[model samples]
Target: MELRLEKFTKRFGDTTVIKDMDLTVGSGEMIALLGPSGCGKSTTLFAVCGIHKMNGGTLHFGDRDVTTVPAQERSVGVVFQNYALYPHMTVEQNIGFPLKIQKLGKAAIRKEVERLSELVQIGELLDRRPAQLSGGQQQRVALARAMIRKPDVLLLDEPLANLDAKLRLEMRSEIRRIQRETGITAILVTHDQVEAMSMCDRIALMKDGKIVQLDTPEQMYSNPRSQFVAGFLGNPPISFLPATAGAEVVLANGQSIARPRDLQASGDLILGIRPEHFGPQHGEGLQGEVIFVEPQGREELIDVRLDGGGDIRSILSAGAPIRQGDRVNWGVATDSILAFAPNGVRV
Candidate 1:
C-alpha cells in the first residue's frame, strides 16, 4: 500500500511539530524517516499510524483518504524501540495477542502464531518468556508480533536502537530481508544515517519540523542539496574550508582551483570535501602538516593542518607510510569538492 501525507501539519498545545510537510511512500517501497532527536521524525511516524491527529492537511492510503481514522482502525502495525514484550507471557502468547484481539478462533490464532515464529526464526523460543531470550531474540519476537496481523503498513520506530553493535548489524540485514520477502510498505524512523542508508530504498531527512531533502541514499551522499544534508550524512563528516570565489577560486593557502560554471556569481563560498576525496599529493598540490593518523583496518584517517592555518581530515590506504609531523601534499579533484553559499544552500 502506498502512504501519502499532503500538507500535513501537527502541533502540541501551541508549538507546531510538523509544518506543511508533504511526503509519499510508494507501494511496497521501504523508506526511512531520518533525523536527529526532537526533529519530529517520531511524531511523523505516529501521525501516519493515526496515533496523533493532524492539525491540518490530509493523509491517504493509496486513493482512500484516512485523514481522520482512529489508530485502532488504521490496520497499521508498529514495533517500538524497547521491543515492548510481555514478561508474563510466552513467545507464542505474545505473537498471538494481536490475533486474539481480532477475534480469530483459537485454532486459527495458534496456527498463525506458529507460522510467524518460524518466519522470524524464533520457532525454538516459542516456549520461553521474554526474560529468557537474548535482546536480539526478543526483538525478533516483537517483529513477529507486528507481522502476525498482515498489516497494511508496517512502522518501525528505532527498532534496533536497544541492541549491541554486532546484533544491530545482524538485525539490519534480517529486517531488510523480511521486508523484501513480505513486500509490505514499511516506514522506518531512525536517527542513524548508516542504518537509513543501508536498509531503505530512499531517505527523507527532516530538520526543524520540516522535510529538508528527500532522495535516495546515493544522491543525498554524492550530491547533497544543502550544507546541512552534506554535513549530516557522512561519518568523520565532510570537512569545510573557507575560500574566495571569482575568476580564480582561491583557497585559504592561496592555491587556486577551477571554479564550477554552475556557481552563479560566487563571492564568498564554502568548500566542502569528504575525507576520502584527498589523494597523494602530486606536483603543485596543496601543502599541509600531518598532525595525527588513525588506523581503521582497511583505511587510515589522517589529520592535516593546512599551511593556511586550518585543520582538515583525509583518508588514505592503510599501507600508506604517512605519519604525524610529516609534511604531505594532497590534491582534491575539482568535481569532488562542493561549494555552498553563505545561506548554507549548495551553489
Candidate 2:
C-alpha cells in the first residue's frame, strides 16, 4: 500500500517534535527514516503506525485517510528493537498470536504459522520458546509474527540494533530479501547509515523534525543536497576544508585546489573531499605532513595536516610507503569535489 503523510505535525505539550513533515512511500517500496536520536525519525514512525496522535496534518494509506485510525486497526505491523515476544510462548504460538487474537481455528493458525516460519527460515525453531532462541533467531520469530497478519505496512524500529556485528550484517540482507518477497510497504527507523543505505530503496534523512533529503541511497550519497547530508552518509566521512573562491578555489593555507570551472559558486566556500578522492601527486597538489595512520587489512586511513594549515584524511593502499610524520603530496579528483557555502548549503 502507498503511504502518504501530508503536513504531518506532532507536538509534546508546548514543544513540537514533528513539523509539517510530508512523505510519500510508494506501494511495495521500502523507505528508511534515518537520522540521529531525537531527530524525530522515531516520532514519525509512531505517528505512521498510529501509536502517537498527530497535532496537525493528514495521513493516508493509499487513498484512504487514516489520520485517526487506532493502532490495532491500522493494518500496520511493528517489529521493535527488543523483539517484544512472549517469553513463555513457543515460536509457533508467537507467530500466530495475531490470528489467535482474532480467534482463528487452531488448525488454520498452525498452518499459517508454519508457512510464515518457513518463509523466515525458522520452521525448525517453531517449537522453541523466545528465551531459547539466539538473538538472530528471536529476530526471525519477531519478523514472522509481524508478517503473519500480512500487514499492508511494516514498521521496523531498529530491528537489528541488538544483534552482533556479524548478525547485523546477515540480518540486513535477510530483511531486504524478506521485504522483497512479501512486497509490503515498509518503513525502517534507524540511526545506522549502513543499514539505511544497504536495505532501503530510498532514504528519508531527517533533521530537526523535517526531512532534509529524500532520495535513493545511491543518489543521497553521490548527490547530497547539503553538507550535513553528505557528511552523514559516508563511511569514513568526507573531509571539509575552509576555502575562498575567486580566481581559483584556494584553501585557507593558500593551496589552490580547483579552478573556476570546477565550482558552481564563488566567494567563501567549503570544499568537501571524500577520503578516496585523494591520490598520489607528483606535481601541483596539496602538500601535507602525515599526522595519523590506521591500518585496516587492505587499506590505510591516513590523516594529513596541510603544510600551511588545515587537515584532511585520505584512504590509500596498504602498500603505500607513507608513514606518520612523512610529508606527502596528494591530488583530489576535481570533478568529484563538493562545494558548499558556509551555511551548509550546496554550492
Q: Pick the candidate with the highest TM-score.
A: 2
TM-score for each model: 0.96, 0.98
Give a tens-digit lDDT track for model 2, residues 194-301: 999999999999999999999999999989999999999998899999899887778999888766465768889888888988768423489989999999989899
Give the clash total for candidate 2.
0
Cα deviation in Å at residue 28, candidate 1? 0.6
RMSD for all candidates, in order, please. Answer: 1.5, 1.2
lDDT by residue (tens digit), candidate 1, 250-333: 887677767755667578888888887766742336688999999999989999988877777888779899878999877776
TM-score (C-alpha) between model 2 and the true structure: 0.98
How many residue pairs clash (N, CA or C atoms closer than 3 angstroms) in each of the candidate models, in the order given? 0, 0
Best by lDDT: 2
Q: What TM-score quantifies how close candidate 1 is to the native fold?
A: 0.96
